[model samples]
Target: MNTQPATRPAFQDRHILVTGAASGIGAAVARQLLAQGARVSAVDLDETGLQRLHAQAPHRAASSRLEDASGHLWTARLDVRDSAQVEQVVAKAQAALGPLDGLASVAGILEMGEVVDLDDAQWQHCFDVNATGVFHVCRAVARRLRERRAGAIVTVSSNAAATPRAGMAAYAASKAAVTQFSRCLGLELAPYGIRVNIVSPGSTDTAMQQAMWAQGSSRAAVIQGDPSRWRLGIPLDKIATPEEIAAAVLFLLSDQASHITLHDLRVDGGATLDQG
Candidate 1:
């Protein structure tokens, strides 16, 4: 693990709400923020994953944790698709951790069926989880931050949003919706001192990717392309690690990016650029 030493505790005493913090990209972002001295309120649908994260303190110094926690981490089980549940969780998280200084919307779902082959329910579920879930979480968080007049938001999208994939129409459309949503939100939030942005990752070696690939034919065949140009369809020779994607999220949320917003930062190892 190549951990970067903190340049400064830019998020010290600040609170961040991380959706899908149970695992993968979300979990990695939470760990990075916690390590940088931020007090985080991690939320996810997986209660067991949250508990495990809480049990394992990501920080070295006990004092780095939010006091009164008894060495435990702040967490909540949230289903982002439920609007009411999202609102309730956001309210509780804010009260527990103080004002939310930032958010990383990483919770999303993926599907791999062609347009005609995908059922309406399947398409809706993809959009509901990946697109609507973002709206709910971002709106809930933004409402509070707007009152405070300061915050930053980074959303995880995908390279497929802009580049076509054979059997990923639903997933790609949902991600594309996410990209546009974030851009619009960025414009709207700027006046309130809030910034919104998107981070679109290329093929990543996460459990979700493996599972989706398993349900299909050969994974290599689905993702492979030319070798001479070193420009495979997935770009990277090996799938990117979750932590690598988290780094891009961290950069967007940091003060170093105060002037940046509405940008689709493609952390795709040049995959997006290769689309023709």
Candidate 2:
């Protein structure tokens, strides 16, 4: 492994696992890593989406379940909500791609509801995937990285975690929980030289965000203040692209962020304001 910075591409020969990778930000992260010469294990609950990603990524693995000739891409269907499954897949990925250099915990579900109307199933499921699911992936990856004593982790979060939102109690609370959880994990792993950070994105152009628009909301509604709900507009006057968020995640995972940990990088186009 030629780790000499100038001799190889950034992430060359590195094994990185990205969850929720079948679409949106996770997919972007996986694709970029493959282009950078990394062996990427992309996992998600969307099997069909995984198939599409396996076929569309830069290295485009010849085998859906295995690495390509360059050993640069692998895809799997993962239900991060299942702890046992999360553990199994993490181990399987490491076995197939060698020790993992880091993790991109992007698996999450979006929930939208007013507190009065929210039900147990919605709230529970929201927390289950958004918060506990992140815990399962991070803990599993952290255990392995702890042994190696070197790695980086970037957990995808959202601006809702820091800022308040109308009709988003469950979603906001769940994200906030994971944000603090990552910070705690970062503190505990610091002694082992493992860096853990969070990427909190605002409104991004993705299927999930598009879903909101599909329900009679317009992109302009997202960019302009929805004062009725108290949702602020994006100061940048544009929605972020998945690639933009992935760029932030990669920066935190790369050596460029070697000295940064327990940090939360916001990619929300200033929707939450700098105070968030």
Identify the candidate with maximal TM-score.
2
Model 1 C-alpha RMSD to native? 4.8
Worst 10 residues of 1 by lDDT: 63-72
lDDT to native, each model: 0.82, 0.89
Which residue runs of candidate 2 sit more than 4 Å off their true CA positions?
Answer: 1-7, 65-70
Q: Which residue pairs in candidate 2 have backbone atoms (N, alpha carbon, C) closer than 3 angstroms, thus clashing?
A: none
- Sliding window of 10 residues with minimal summed lDDT for model 2: 61-70
> Which candidate wins on lDDT?
2
* Tens digit of per-residue lDDT, candidate 2, span 227-249: 88878899999999999999999
Error of 2 at 251 (Å): 0.3
**21 in model 1: Cα distance from truth in Å?**
0.6
User: Residue 15, candidate 2: how far off, in angstroms?
Assistant: 0.8
Error of 2 at 203 (Å): 0.2
Compose the digit string of candidate 1's lDDT tens values, residues 109-160: 8777778899999999999999999999999999998999998999999988
